[model samples]
Target: MGNIYAGVDLGGTTVKLGLLTDEASLIRKWEIPTRKDDGGKQVIPDIAASIKKNMEEEGIRFSELAGAGLGVPGPIRQDGYLEVCVNIGPGMRDMNPVKDLSGLLGGIPVKGGNDANVAALGEMWQGGGKGYRDVVAVTLGTGVGGGVILDGHIVAGSKGMGGEIGHMVMDWDWKEAEVCNCGNRGCLEQIASATGIARHARIFMRESDRPSVLRDLQRVTARDVFDAAKAGDGLAEDVADYCMMYLARAMAYVSQVVDPEIFVIGGGVSRAGQYLLDLIKEHYDPLIKLTRGKAKLALARLGNDAGIYGAAKMVIDEREK
Candidate 1:
């Protein structure tokens, strides 16, 4: 056999792993529970054990493996170290996972990157943005996440904050804006994320006695609002429009800076499908008049698997060099 690569998408609840050939063909993929106890100290060991076990089952020796790459949830310093992964555990703060994980895995080459950034790279490499070198990936999950790829490389920035499109300020005056987890008010994430979408729906229902199908549900989800809007609920439509407006505005700002060829929309809320893309483009087109029709907007193809593909791609690229 030639060489194999391992990709690891390390999330707060689960650690997703993928074994891929040097040619980027994924042979096997699996997941393991993320043990957050002991400040996430067991996470690395568990990941190492899992990779080894899987390799053994495949009858591939460790020597045939090329390298491993990890996608972390928190900010990654330029030195291949994570500043602090709050969702994973407190003990993982300022940890050098790239170096430690490599040691555990018998010193095979290793690389690491931010989860969102790696996801963007994945989409650019083998997913929605496959043909595009300059791409921006936006994930509308519980909170908004983003990754920027310029010339087929991740722009992680000095502090790994380059592609932080979610935290982009949307509400300048903080008027009618709630505080974000980043301790800011008016972030795009506060209005465009799934949590933000649901929050807006609740606010609309509470502020206006608008007869919305969403009013029937005790808990309003982003999907509920989208479904209601699609079902012709005026109130839900307005709420959804409000959310997309902020996302479009943020995209316009991003366009002025990087001018990516396409924007890949991902995450749970993206399940809203083309309707969501239409809403964003409807609002987005008017904002960036000069760059009209230049940047195409589409949905992400890989879904949750994008991260592992991206993580593996990182190692593959290194090996190729």
Candidate 2:
């Protein structure tokens, strides 16, 4: 047994905590409901308490920990300050998570980072990006999220918005494009996200007489479109192709800049699996002119646990430093 480390994935609904050895072996993992009372002021304290409780039960002590790391939904500055976490609450805005959590844990060293970026690190450390140093991770869920890892370190950029692949503009004209939550028009998130896939299906069904089983359902999802497309539904097929095409375009654009060795796709929409990868490659292969077919794509191996793993990796890396 080696020194234990703690990792926290703080979300709007739940806080996932994991205890891992210095060797990156997960010893225990658990979750607790996020109490948003008092503007999320209790989140850090609650996490510390949970870790202490669990360590006590496991016959471990705080002194035995190498360090701790926290992953937040919002951007995290280089100094471990959370610029703003809208999903958590207003109180967490402009707070130093590293200091707050460390204070609660008796001055133990703590690290903080953007949740999506940390998830990418987790993938690189033990998931799909394993055995590779330079990697790009794309998460397709309700909205698109991405993280860039080069030389086994996260590229959070100056303001912690480096790997925001979702905001990449796909349509410069804004023609037939919907406004993204980021106030941008024709962002990759507008067309390639899960919500975007379903929206495309709805629009296709409305514009054309092409029949699809999606028409029978009250609501269509990205999964429904993939399933219908696999079953030879022309309408759903079009929708799937459109979404994957845009996603590939985004990846193609990223490849030109970062030139990652591999792309690890994750999140709910990625459940489409090899079918989704094939669709992406079908379009991706044509767009690359220089580094053609160099970047390989793979599915993310660590589902929801990527964040915690990445967080723990942050601590482990810091100890090495």
Candidate 3:
């Protein structure tokens, strides 16, 4: 039998796992509840047990496995050590996940990376950025998250905080912006994320007496705003334009650094589809004066599965080397 690779995407609520062939084709995939009791100490052991059980069920042997890769939610050191994974648990702070996981799997080589970075890798491998090695992936969910890929490898940076595009300060004036989850005001996450969209919608509705279809709904959501804009609601369109402008400006700043060939937009809000891409491009094009061409923008294809695919690809790439 050909060699297979294991991938794990560890989240606070669940741990997603996948088995893939050497070519990065997934053979099977599954998940397990994350036991975060005891400060996430059981997370690694549980992952190890799940992989072993699945391998047994499939009649696969350890010798035929390339190794395992993990996508963690927090910052990771260059040496595969975690600085602190707040979502996982308190015990995960300052621990070497790669070393611990490798030991648990009987010395099987294990690699770990920030979940966003790993997801970016997944997109480059099989999703929107498939043809491009240098790419930037931006996730516009409740909060913003990003990953930077340079020369087909993740730019983890010195503190594994590379590709943290969401936290970029966009507005310095606190009076006009709300504080972000990071305890900062005017972060890109505060203006460009799904939550930010909803927040902007509320502000627009309150500040203006302009008629908006969005006013009919008791609760306003990012989707509601986008749908209303598509229906020609003037206020909704303004809100959408505002959100995209900030996002575009952020990408323009990023271009000065890595200048990726493409920007893959993912996460819940990206479901807005082509309209969102068009809106972003319309705003982004004018901001870049020196770059030869405007950066390409595309929606992420893998959805939630990007992390697992990228995780498996991590191990596969290592084995190939």
Q: Rate the local accuracy (lDDT) of all candidates.
A: 0.90, 0.90, 0.90
Residues 5-120 of candidate 1 have per-residue lDDT tens digits of 89999999999999988666989999999999999999999999999999999888878888998999999965688888989887688889888889998888889999999999
Runs of candidate 1 exceeding 4 Å displacement: none
Positional deviation of residue 13's Cα in model 3 after best superposition, in angstroms:
1.6
Clashing pairs in 2: none
lDDT of 3 by residue, 61-91 (tens): 8677768999999999768989889887887
Winner by lDDT between candidate 3 and candidate 1:
1
- Pairs that collide in candidate 1 are none
Please report how far candidate 3 places residue 41 from its true position, in Å. Answer: 1.1
Error of 3 at 126 (Å): 0.4
Q: Which 10 residues in a row give candidate 3 its minimum summed lDDT?
A: 173-182
Question: After aligning candidate 2 to the native by TM-score, how far in Å is the CA of 142 from where it should be?
Answer: 1.3
